[model samples]
Target: MTLAVTGGAGFIGSNFILYMREKYPDLRIISIDCLTYASNRFVIDKLSCDANFRFSKTDICDRNEIYRLFEEEKPDILVNFAAESHVDRSIDGSEQFLRTNVLGTGVLLDACLRYGIKRFHQISTDEVYGDLPLEGDDPPFTESSPLNPGNPYSASKAAADLLVLSYSRTHGLPITVSRSVNNYGPLQHGEKFIPTVINSVLRGKNIPVYGNGKNVRGWLYVRDHCAAVDLILKNGREGEIYNVGATDYLQNIELAELICDRMRASRDLITFVSDRPGHDRRYDIDCTRLKTDTGWSPETAFSAGIEKTIEYYK
Candidate 1:
């Protein structure tokens, strides 16, 4: 089977590609990435040495290149991980996010239609459900939750999800979506929350916290997320949206403190910063549907995951 993984040079995408390769030694895996700033060329370079793996530095928004590659490779499955995912960058300018996340997804869908892919999996985030109150019994977002994107980044992703579903309904495409919470592990971009904390501790620099640092977010180990996606690809029902998440969650301040303690650094390293506009107070998600459907559950505890992440950065 030929599998095309977009944004395969990025953090999560690279990890997923490595997971797939290890599990399916004979499978032909193609890493498709546009080599954005967040991309890891070292990972791509290492994977390219594998006989069953191929790399394409191609953008998903480029219809011609995507179509050409689709026609030539005729991939059996295409998993989209491509997007301008940074919320801060999205707030600064939404046009690039729209072009890459929305229009790029459309272009991929068109290619999937023309080239006839067996399955098209979309990698999405729980942020699409917007924010919950910092404290309350508010129910976590389910697969049926209405999309209420709080930022341009999530809005773009939500739009892509809707577009994918529309194609499935209108054109009979086999597609599935997974909305997951924050993922942390090896190869994460330095600008991301966890990595920033680790890097700050290692460099003896202050760890910046947004607002009063009360925002809550669920955390999932990247490998667990990759495993869930693999299961969805193998056994997930078509035209279904699955919520993949773990119970591990922490407020921004708490998370920073935990990392400092774990690293044996001073808590004084943490500094509060002004919050971004429309910052979500919290994000919670329910993965009961995914567990019921595929018997998938998170394996790594937050403590273990954080330790591994810190070691990687060290």
Candidate 2:
């Protein structure tokens, strides 16, 4: 199938591209990206010789440009992985997030309607459901959870998800949404938690932890996330939202400790810093629907994934 993937050069997107190429050798892929600071051009450098791959350097918010490409490629599927994903950056400057995540998503949806694309897949984060209660017996976030985004990044994404659903209903567009947990793997930007901690430890610097480092997060390996997306796009029911995550949950300090242990570094390097505003104490997603429907589950165990991540950084 011919597919148009936005943000294809970014961390998770790059892995997904590589996965698709290996899994479906002849499938044609059109990659649309702005090459933002977080985008890793090197990831797709090796794909240049493949006849099935094409990279277009353009903003997703550019409706005219996106429409031009859509008309040319006549893609069957459009998976939107584009957005300002970092919470800190969003907090510092939220306008760009809104433009890219909210407005840009609107543009893509409009294009799908105009072009009559078969499927539109939105890559979203579990943060849109806000944080789970850290100290209680609260259950994980299901697809039915009310969106309570605590930061600008998640707020914009939440708005985008709404727009996607609206188009699915009003315009008769086939749309699917996948909200996944924290993704940690190769090509991740240094500003994220795992990368930041790794870099600091490797450089013999203090490992900074936010808010006593007790905040918890559910982790998913990038490859596993990529696999889930493929299954969802292939078999997922339209207008359905699926949560993607393994049950692995780790507190900030626990994660730091894991990294330190992997690096053979000292926990003494761990340092607590002021927490960001609206820091979610915990995040967990109930992906039972995805598992039950598609028989998709995370393959990489935390220890194995963490080791691979460290090796990639080293």
Candidate 3:
């Protein structure tokens, strides 16, 4: 089977490609990435020697380029991971997020319809459900939850999710959307929280925290996320949305403190700052559907994952 994965050079995409290549050695894989700032080719450089792997530098927003890739590759499975995913950056500039997350998704769905692809997987985020009332003991966001995207980045992702569902309903497209929570592991860029904390502590710099840093997020190890995606792609029901998470919840400040403790850095380096506009107070995902259907659960403990991630940066 030939799989086309967009944004294959980005953090999650690169890790997914590596996982897929190792697990399914005979499967042909074509990765298309625009090599944006967060993209790193070095991650997949070793896979160049594998006959089953191919990489193309292309933008998903360009209709002609996307069409050409579809025609040339004729992928059996299409996974759209291309997006401008940073929340802070999205607050500063939303145009790229809208273009890539919303319009790019539309273009890919159109191409899927034109090409008769078997399965289309849309990688979404828990941020689409926005912040839950931190005051109450409410359950996490589930597939049936209403979307209340707080930031432009999440709004764009929510728009893309709706687009995929529209295509599936109207055009009879075989699509599955997986909404995952905060992912932290190796190869992540320095802008993200975990990496930022680790890098800053190593450099003896203050670890910046937004607000009081009490915002809660469910953390999922990147490899476990890849495993869940693999299961969803193969056995997931069409037009169904699955939430993937490890059920590991931690406050932003708590996470930073854990990193500091692990790295032998003083908590004095922690500095609170003004929160970004539209910052969601907390994000949590209910992975019950995924767990019940696929029997998929995260195997990595938070401490272990953080240690491994920190070591990778070192």
Candidate 4:
């Protein structure tokens, strides 16, 4: 089978391409990426020798380009991972978020309808569900939960989710959406929380934490997320939404301390900074539906995942 993976040069997309290539040696992958600032081509250089893998430097928002690619590749599966994902960046400028997340997703859905693709999987974020109370009184967000995105980034993603579902209902396209929590692993951009903390601590610089550093996030190892996506691509029901997470929640302050401790750095280096606007207080996901439907659970423990991630940055 042939697959088309958009945003293949970014962190999660690149890792997913590597995982798919290794697991299905006979399957071909046509990877299209715009090579934005966070994108790194070196991640997929090793695959250059594989005849089954092809790379195209193209933007998903380009209608003609995306349609041309669909006609040329004729992929059986299409997975869209392209988006302006940083919440802070989105707050600063929302145009890119709307263009890529909303318009780009619409373009891909149109192409899928024209190509008659067997499966279209959309990779989404837990932030689309907005913040949970720090009191821990309310239950975690499930697939059935109402969308209440606070930040521009999340609002754009939530819009894309609706677009995908609309295509499924209006055009009868086979599609599935997976909303995952914060992902941390190697190859992630240096601007991200985990990588920034690890890099700063290793370099003997003050680790910056926003506000009181008490904002909570559910952490999901990147590899485990790839595995869950693979399962969904293979066996997931059409027009369904799945919440994927490891059920591990950590406060920002606590996570920073863990990294500092792991790197043998003193907590004195921790610095609290002004908080970003529209920052979600906490994010937690209820993965019961995903678990019951796909029999997939995260295998990497938080401690182990953190160690591995720290080693990668070191």
Candidate 5:
């Protein structure tokens, strides 16, 4: 099967590409990326010799460029991972986020419709559901949860998701959406929480903690996410949404402490800073649908995953 994956040079996308390359050698894969600040150039270097893999430096927002590549490649499946994903960056300037996440998604959807692709999978974030109370009796968000995005980044994602669903209903486009929780592993950009802490510890710099650092986040290892997506690609029904996440919910302070403890650094190195605007107090999602339907579950424990990530950064 021929698959086209946008933003394959980014963290989760790169991990997915690597996982697929190793698991399915005969799968013809086309990875297109615009080389944004978050893109990892080194990840695609390893695929240089694989006859089945092709890398294209193209943006999903560029209709002509995406259409040209689609015409040439004629891929059966398109997995869109290309997006301006950083919340902090989006808060600073929202134009790029809207352009890439909303408009770019429209461009891709148009191409997928015109090309008559079998499936168009959109990789998404659980933040589109906004936050749950830090101290609450409310159940974790499920696939049926309402879209109540808080930040520009999430708003853009939510907009794209609505567009995807509209196309599925109105145009009969085959589509699947996977909304995942916080991803932590190797090749994640240095700006993310885990990598930022790792980099700070290595450089002997104080790790900045936002507010009281008690915001909870459900962490999913990147490889596990990749496997889940693979399962969804193979078995997920079209016009459906799947939530992918691990049960390891840790507060920001607790996560920071664990990293410091693992690296033999002092907890005093963590400095409390002002919280970012619209920071979600907690992020937890229910993956029961994915687990029951696809027989998929997270394989890596948080402790083991964090250890691997620490070793990678070291």
Candidate 6:
């Protein structure tokens, strides 16, 4: 089978490509990326000699190029991971986020409709449900939860999700959506939380903590997330939205402290700073649907995953 993965040079996208390549040695994988600042082309370069692997420098927003590529590749499945995903960048200027996240999604959906595909998976995020109370006993967000995006970044994603659902309903397009929590593992951009902490410790610099760093986030290892996406592609029902999350979760401060302890760095390096506008207090999602439907669950323990992550950075 042939699979086209957008943003395959970025963090989770690169990990997913590598995981799929190893898991299905015979699978033909086409990775598409425009080589953005956060993208690492070196990850894909290692596979340059593999006959089953191909890379294309393409932008999802370029409708003509996307259509041309789809016609040539005729991929059986398409997984879109392309987006401007930084919250701070989105707040500074939302136009790019809207263009890439929402409009780019629409372009891809149109391309799918133009050229038939067996499955089109839209990778979404739990931030679409907005923030949960940090101290409440409120249940994690389910698939049916109303979308209440708190930031421009998440708002764009929510719009894209709605567009994907609309295409499925109006055009009978085969589609699946996975709203996953924060993922951490190898090849993550340095701007992300864990990577920032690791880089700061390595450079003997202060680690900036936003608003006391108490914001909570559910964490999943990138490889485990890739496994879940694989299962979703194979066994997930059509036109369904699955929430992907793991049992591992903690406050930002706790995570930072643990990293410092593991690295034998001083916790005093953490410094509280002014928080960003509309920062979500917490992110929680229920993965019952994903687990029940795909028989998938995270295998990486929190501590073990952190150890692996630290080793990778080191």
TM-score of 2: 0.98
Error of 3 at 24 (Å): 0.3
Local error of candidate 6 at residue 107 (angstroms): 1.0
TM-score of 6: 0.99
- 206-249 in candidate 4: lDDT tens per residue? 99999999999989889999999999998788999999986488
- What is the alpha-carbon lDDT of model 5 when measured against the actual structure? 0.93
lDDT tens digits by residue: candidate 6, 1-314: 89999999999999999999999999999998888898997657889999999999999899999999999999999999999989999999999999989999999899999999999999999999999988979998999999999999999999999999999999999999999999999999999999999999999999998997899999999999999999999999999999999658899999899999999999999999999888999988889999899999899988899999999998
Residue 265 lDDT, candidate 3, scale 0-100 = 93
TM-scores, all candidates, are 0.99, 0.98, 0.98, 0.99, 0.99, 0.99
- Badly placed stretches (over 4 Å) of model 3 are none
Model 6 alpha-carbon drift over 4 Å, by segment: none
Kindly report which residue stretches of model 2 are placed more than 4 angstroms away from their true locations once superposed. none
Task: List model 2 lDDT by residue over 195-293, tens digit each.
Answer: 999999899999999988889999999999999999998889999999998648999899999899889999999999999998988998889999988
Worst 10 residues of 6 by lDDT: 37-46
Q: lDDT tens string, model 3, 173-249?
A: 99999999989998888899999999999999999999989898889889999999999998788999999976488
Across 199-270, the per-residue lDDT of candidate 5 in tens digits comes to 999999999989999999999999999999999989998999999977599999999999999999998899
Question: Which is the winner by lDDT between candidate 4 and candidate 6?
Answer: 6
Q: Which window of ten consecutive residues has the lowest lDDT sum in model 4?
A: 41-50
- After superposition, candidate 5 runs with Cα above 4 Å error: none
Better of 2 and 5 by lDDT: 5
Count residue pairs with overlapping backbones in model 5: 0
At residue 178, candidate 5 shows an lDDT of 96
Local accuracy of candidate 1 as per-residue lDDT tens digits, 87-163: 99999999999999999999999999998999999999999999999878999899998999999999999999999
